[model samples]
Target chain A: MEKKYVIGIDLGGTKISGALATVEGDIISQYTVPTKASEGELPVLGRIIETIEKVLEEGKAVVEEVKSIGIGSPGPLDTKTGVIITTPNLPFKNFKLVQPIVEKFGIPTYLDNDANAAAIGEYVFGAGKGTENMVFITVSTGIGGGAIINGKAFRGSTSNALEVGHMTLEQDGPICGCGNHGCAEALASGTAIGKRAKEAVTQGLKTSLANYENPGSYEVFQEAAKGDDVAKEILDKALTYLGICVGNVITSFDPEMVIIGGGVSQGGAVVFDKVKEVVKERCFETLAENCKIVPAGLGTDAGVKGAVALAILESK
Target chain B: MEKKYVIGIDLGGTKISGALATVEGDIISQYTVPTKASEGELPVLGRIIETIEKVLEEGKAVVEEVKSIGIGSPGPLDTKTGVIITTPNLPFKNFKLVQPIVEKFGIPTYLDNDANAAAIGEYVFGAGKGTENMVFITVSTGIGGGAIINGKAFRGSTSNALEVGHMTLEQDGPICGCGNHGCAEALASGTAIGKRAKEAVTQGLKTSLANYENPGSYEVFQEAAKGDDVAKEILDKALTYLGICVGNVITSFDPEMVIIGGGVSQGGAVVFDKVKEVVKERCFETLAENCKIVPAGLGTDAGVKGAVALAILESK
Candidate 1:
């Protein structure tokens, strides 16, 4: 019999979501459960496994029918060795996340960083579909990215290419989590925007944001849209940094498209317009003209769908 | 007879050099002729063909014995269409360079930007020989680069990737020849270094560099070596910017090696040391550790040899 199904697990800090899908990516069954990360490594691992089993049972599918399993998790992990080398949200520490699953299900498995999975997802089914080369940048609390090179996910020597968040934009700007100063993440990430806004609120800046006890990028975007001078100023500064980051990426990669995703991209035109304007001003006219910068197409179910896309891609 | 030979042409403003070589890249015969670009497009085209004929005759090889012809020239050209799209030094304007050669010789032909050809040369036979992923940066009058991704030259959508010279480092840096401000080329190219020294001399800065009639990077390096503080400071700033440019490349590509080539790199220890130090300071530790940053191994013949490598690699 032909293999007709695949399983995808999206391991997040709070929830473990699993999907049983056809080779075409239609989800037949899904299950979700708490990660209970505080319960430590094995328990969290057990929960991931339990969700997979639940999706299989609910879909009335056999492990033999599933072509492969793909798991998407936060990383700094080794994809080739399948070790979660200690991500912040997940409890796994140098844990062999794929071996036990392969043993239990007797199926081929693939593991990748969430950003890479998301890039593959976009390449296979989202806004980046049909692009020979593209970059997916997710700008939420942090800025992260992945590249689709020659129509495939490109993992560099250390399985860690497209670390755009760490690209230094300002030589003497804010410190980044990676111990570098002036990184794109340090200057333009959602966290950076929120921090700047909170500081302004605390400093008694004349803005409507002072209404919130504690404000972040969400409130700052809201206030900016409502005509707050301080809020507008903060978004302009942060978004310019974001634009420079995108411009630099375009200069370096010269990809067909740049797909912006994550919480910040949800701000829509305000975000896209500024990035396009800056890219036009900074990049070579040829590069700027040839490339399209747009928002990610994957919605709330992006994580799980990304994992499914990863399975289908890697399996092929 | 078995096809066991290739031809390489290094196209330049004043000279055209062609080589007939073994499939393995040993030069069997070579020829050089003045470009006489002032004679216009067809005359320059005829000169290139003449060089090819000269090399073939000198090598005592027939067309049937040659596998392919490769030409390396100044770019913004279309490798896909074999068109030389108006280069500064070359008289060709949207000229179809490869088709004529292929028609005359009845052999496959390839054309690539000089930088991309040089990168393939390094990947095949120079410092980047063993790297699966590497970036080649040549910091001469301008800074240009090429990337080898997964052991292949990766030209993005428009076949014009790795335009690193234009990457913005300073938001308000000195204007570049491209009319952009704060490009890596504007801040760190050998031309930029020379321009800075000229400005210093014109300003009557207290430095030995002022002793030269028209001071440039060579004089600056010389004076800096003699302990001229002004020259040393200029070098420090320029090399720092170069380092930041390289650091950002490492951060974005995560390649196994970064090969620095071209005229400025001949400064040796001063260039390498500062770039290495900055990369360590600015890039993620893991990326820095995994990537080897080194000067290019190819010497005077890199251009022609690169054309040879381009023929062999692309034909394969």
Candidate 2:
């Protein structure tokens, strides 16, 4: 029989989502379960195994029908070595993910950073298709990024390339989680957006955002859209930082396009339009003229589909 | 005769150098002429043509064997259009370099940024030979950079990808000529080094550098080597900035190696040792361990050799 199926696992902070998909990239079935962080590695592994089993059962496929498994997890993980070195969100440190998954499933396994996997998903099936070079940026609680060059993930010399979020935009702007000052993440991340809103409220600034019991970034954006002066100021500051970061990426990489994703990007045109304007104004004319900035197309399914792509590619 | 040769021209603000080289990269003959750029573009173009003719004459029989010509000059140039759009050092504005060379020599000509040509030269025949990914940084009057990825010059989405020197290391440390704040060039270029030395002298910091009638970076390095506290302090500051820039590049690109050139890099082990120390300190352990830093081996001949490489590759 022809080889037709692959397994894709997206290991998030709280759950593991696994899917079995056909070679054509159509998902056959999927399973999801709690990651149980406090239960440690063995329990997490058990959950992953259960998810894989459930997906296979739902697909009604024998073990021989599956090709390989791919896992997309938060990093500093070693893609070459298949080790999850130390991810703050995950319970295990230096977890040997590949060997365990391969042994348990009796098939090959591959691992990659979630952001990189998402970038590959974009490159192969989403917004970056047909482009030789692209940058994918996800602006959530913390910002993350990935690069695609020449149709493959550009994994820098050490699998740590495309850290666009860590690049400094304002040298003296704010303290970052990475212990740096004025990093792009420190200025424009979801955390930063909320922090700005909170500071404005505490500083006696008048705004509709103050009505939220605890104003998060989304609420601030909501308030700003509704014509709250303080919320508008905070949103503007976030956009300015976001724009500079976008300009910096455009200048440094010169990618054909940049795909913006993550929760904060859900602000939609409010963030996207302003970022496009700032990047156009600040980046070199040549770069600004050529680069197209677009929202990520895959949305919530990007991670799982990226993992599936990895499985198919790695297995072959 | 076996496929003839190519003319490689390197245009600088003060001089124009051209070489007649075999397809195998063996130089048959070379010549240089004063640009006298103060007199402006027409005269400079005249000097460039004269140098090309002089080299062809010296090569004699090899002239008949020449295939194409390539010119490497300072940018911002339109590589696709073969036009020098604007170069701070050159008098020309929007000079069409290719039309003139092709018109006069009756050979297809290629034009690229000097830094990019140097990078291609290094990639093909110099320090970066056999490597698919590398970054070449030249620290002269100002810092300039180029990138080679997958055995070709990585010219971003447009023809202007690697402007490493302009990347910010200190968000607000110093103002750069490019109208940016805290660019790597502003912190560690030869001009920056010279500025620090002059400032120290004006501030009445005691140092052996004070004895020099006209202090340059070379004298400053000499004084620092001799254990002048102020000189050492300034040199360390420069090294710190250079190291951060290097670390950032390493983190961002993941190239197998980074080659340093230009006059300031010629300060030898003093700058090299400091740069290595800082890169190790700032970069992730895996990246720091995997990447190598080395001095550029091509010396002043890099540009001409790189232009030859460009011609050979483009002709093919």
Candidate 3:
């Protein structure tokens, strides 16, 4: 039978989402399940397999009809060996994630880090479509990125390229989770913004932030929009650092476009405006003028689509 | 006739060097001439043409035996259009440097920025000969770089990727020649080191540097080696920033190797040690450990070889 179907699994810490889609990316059926990652490796793996089965059943698709399976997971994992090396949220520790899947399904399987998968998704089906070079950045609890160079994923020597978040933006700024000082993630990520807000409230600074039990970037954006000076100041500082990170990316990569996504990017005009201004200030005029920085085109359902994109592109 | 030869031209502000080489990168004949750029565009173009002819005659090779001709020059230039948009050292402004040469020789010609040409040279014939992914950085009066991705020159959308020098290392640090503050070039380049020593001497700081008519990085390196406090302090600070820049490159690109070239890199152990230290401190342990950081392999004749590499690689 002609292979017209593919399976895409977004393996996250809290949940696993799977989709059965046409080769052209039209989703026929999808399923989601709680990961219960604390249950250890085998149980979580079973849940992921279950997710695949449910999607296939709902879509009325057989294993022979599927071209391939693609898994997008949190990583420090080995993409070449198809192993989930070790990740904080997941239970896998150098687990051979792809081997079992491919054996069970009797189909080719591919696995990549979530950031890289998302970048491929953007390059193939979202905002970065048609561009040979683009960067996809996610500014959530932490900053992470992936790059498409010459129309293919640039995985560097060890499949760890485009670790833009860990880049040192300031020589002596705040200490980062990576044990480095002045990393972009330490200064600009959603977690960083929340930590700063928490520090301000704890210091007895006068602000509306104290009113919230816990103010993350979402609450800060809300308060800033309502004219809270403390909130506005915090947003301004964090976004400025974010802008510097984006600017540095432009200076380093000179890609055709940079697509920003994730929690912090949801702040709308404030985030993009600051990033654009700083990029122009930091990069060459021609590069700044020619490259476009915009929000991600994919929406809330981007996770499965990104996995699907990984499957589609890698299969080709 | 067998295509056994190629011509390479290194077009610099003060002088232009040309080479005729076998397809295997063995230089058969070479010649050099003053650029005389102030005389106007055509004169310089004529000199380039004349140099190519001389190399061919000296090598006892004809146009039929040459596969292609390559030119490496100072830029902001269009590699796609064969146009030099403008450069500080060269007198070309939107001048088509490749067209007339191709017309005269009846052979394919390629033009690229010097940094990129050097990168290609390293990838093909120097320290990075076997590296599939490597970054070539030249830290001189200013810092500039180029990258080899998957064994090809990975110039981005505008043919201007790998501008690692301009990445912000300090948010409110010294202003750069590009009018930005805290660029890697502003903080750690040979020019920056020289500027710092000059300022200290001018301010009448107690140091042996004041004994000299003019002080530069070479002088600072000498004094620091002899245990001059001011010079040592300057070297320490500048090298730290240079380390940070290299660390940032490691974080961003995660290439197999980063080969540092140009004037400042010649400071020997002091420069390499400081850069390695900072890179380890600021980068991921796996990346810092895995990525090789070393001095460039090609020496004084690197310019002509770089141009030749550009021709050889592009022709394929």
User: Could you say which candidate leads in DockQ?
Assistant: 3
TM-score of chain B, per candidate?
A: 0.98, 0.93, 0.98
Q: Is the docking of candidate 2 incorrect, acceptable, medium or high quality?
A: acceptable
Q: DockQ scores for all the models shown?
A: 0.79, 0.44, 0.83
Off by over 4 Å in 3: none
lDDT of each: 0.91, 0.83, 0.91
By lDDT, the better pick of 2 and 3 is: 3
Q: Between the candidate structures 1 and 2, which one is better when assessed by TM-score?
A: 1
Candidate 2 per-residue C-alpha lDDT over B1-316 given as tens digits, one digit per residue, 9 for 90 to 100: 5567888999888778899888878998999888788897787878878888888899884444678888899998888889898888877899987888778877888899998899888887888887888999889888888888767677776678777777756545678887777778889998998888888888888887788777878887888888989889888988878877787777678789999989998998988888888777655677778888998979768878888888886787
Model 2 lDDT tens row, A62-133 = 678888888999998889889888888877898887888788778788899998888877887789888988
lDDT order of candidates, top first = 1, 3, 2
**Model 1, A1-316: lDDT tens per residue?**
5689988899888898999999999999999998888899888879888988999999999887999898999998898988889887766679898998888878888899999989988888899988889999999999999999987789898988899998888888888888888899988889999999999988988989899988899998999999999999999999999999999999999999999999999999999999999999999888999999999999988999999999998898
Across residues B250-309, which tens digit of lDDT does each residue of candidate 1 receive?
888999999999989999999999999999998878899999999998999999999999
Clashing pairs in 1: none
- Flag regions of model 2 displaced more than 4 Å: A1-7, A20-24, A36-70, A93-96, A99-110, A170-175, A195-216, A219-238, A311-316, B1-7, B20-26, B35-70, B91-110, B169-175, B193-238, B311-316
Q: How well is candidate 2 docked (DockQ)?
A: 0.44
Model 2 chain A weakest 10-residue run by lDDT = A164-173
Provide the lowest-lDDT 10-residue window in model 1 chain B.
Answer: B86-95
For candidate 1, what is the lDDT?
0.91
Per-model root-mean-square deviation over C-alphas = 1.2, 4.3, 1.2
